[model samples]
Target: MKKQRPPGLIAIVAYKAFVASLLTVTSIALLFALKNHKILENFSESYLLETKLKIIELLLDKFLIVKPKTLLFSGLAAGFYAGLTAVEALGLWYQKGWATILVLVLVGISIPPEIYELFQGLTLLKLAVFIANLAVLWYLLHHLPKHGKAD
Candidate 1:
């Protein structure tokens, strides 16, 4: 008989999958923007005029200043991250030990940078992400010993 996965494990897998999807979309959008920079700028200008939201305006300003090479690099990086996240999700779904370690190490590595960013600017989004990663790390650490022989 096969062992059933715990709900927390399922939640972790789902969260990773969701993050992968978001990253995939972001990668695609950035790539598309790179290809159609002029069109995007025009569209954004019109959209900005219609909305006039300060946050959107600020984001658009930043977007407008980004060079094509930067866009390409960002797009590639996001795509690579998306791929990594998808792998993590798949490995966890199959209850692979390496996947757990991969997630732990990756999440662990990100913590210092996240804290630094928070110190730089304490935004709600940053706080939420930090909290989420911490929760995932805590859950994995607490549950790992019980699972045993991950390999």
Candidate 2:
């Protein structure tokens, strides 16, 4: 019989679930974007609310025009990653060694990109995310059982 995991450990699993949910939503939104490319254009034309057109146009400029194939491929990739994260969450909840390995690898790989982003510009949000990731990586690496169920 296995013992219960600590609150911190469980929190990480919960975080993973939250991330998986977010990615799933993003995937759907991207797929929908393909069909609803000019939703704002259509709405403004019909609703006659074009006073703040400059702001709307500026916001639209930042968004990329995604093709159906691009959205589908991106959605599939996001879904695959979300699935991996969900599985990792489950395994971690059960105190599996392989889960730790997977998390360590994923988080470790993510650190470099995060740091690069920070160098591009420092923001409270980016700093917080980097700190959180670092803390999670540290916690899992140090606390995981030396010999536990894995593979």
Candidate 3:
């Protein structure tokens, strides 16, 4: 059997998806680290009482109140999601097994909650990001090799 090249569209979409996932993972990790380090624990509110700084200080206070275990688990889940996305992208790019199909199913399951968020109030940025993700997932799933191993 001859190895086939993945479709150009699939390559582009998968690479974009890979980058998105990487960014998501990195952002989540950074948030976790910042919360864990308690670097904001001792900022003198009286000295740095500017409105913007106050708002951030208040937000960090709320964030720091969340349970550490919960934060850790959420961070781990985000990492797993990103790792799986990377795998999906690799599979799509290589025209390997059914990774694209798996990713589509995962995305399909995920969209309902996001759609509800959209219905509540959809920002242009949120809509664009969701649409781009859907488009990439669809393109890769659609262009997957017609014949391949069951795995």
> 118, model 1: CA deviation in Å?
1.1
Candidate topping TM-score: 1
Q: 38-95, model 2: which lDDT tens digit per residue?
A: 7744654543445667666555544444556887788888888889989988988878
lDDT of 3 by residue, 47-90 (tens): 57455577777776776676667666667776777777777767
Candidates by TM-score, descending order: 1, 2, 3
Error of 2 at 85 (Å): 1.1
Tell me how far the alpha carbon of residue 83 in candidate 3 is from the true structure, in angstroms, after superposition: 0.7
lDDT of 3 at 116: 87
- lDDT by residue (1-151, candidate 1, tens digit) is 9888989889889999999999999999999989998876886678555766777767777898999999999999999999999999998888888888889999999999999999999999999989989998999999886543547
Query: What total of clashing residue pairs does each candidate reach?
Result: 0, 0, 0
TM-score of each: 0.84, 0.80, 0.69
Supply candidate 1's per-residue lDDT for 84.
100
Question: Which portions of model 2 show Cα errors greater than 4 Å?
Answer: 38-49, 52-58, 64-70, 146-148
Full-model lDDT, candidate 1: 0.89
- Which sections of candidate 1 miss by over 4 Å? 41-60, 148-150
Between which residue pairs do clashes occur in model 2?
none
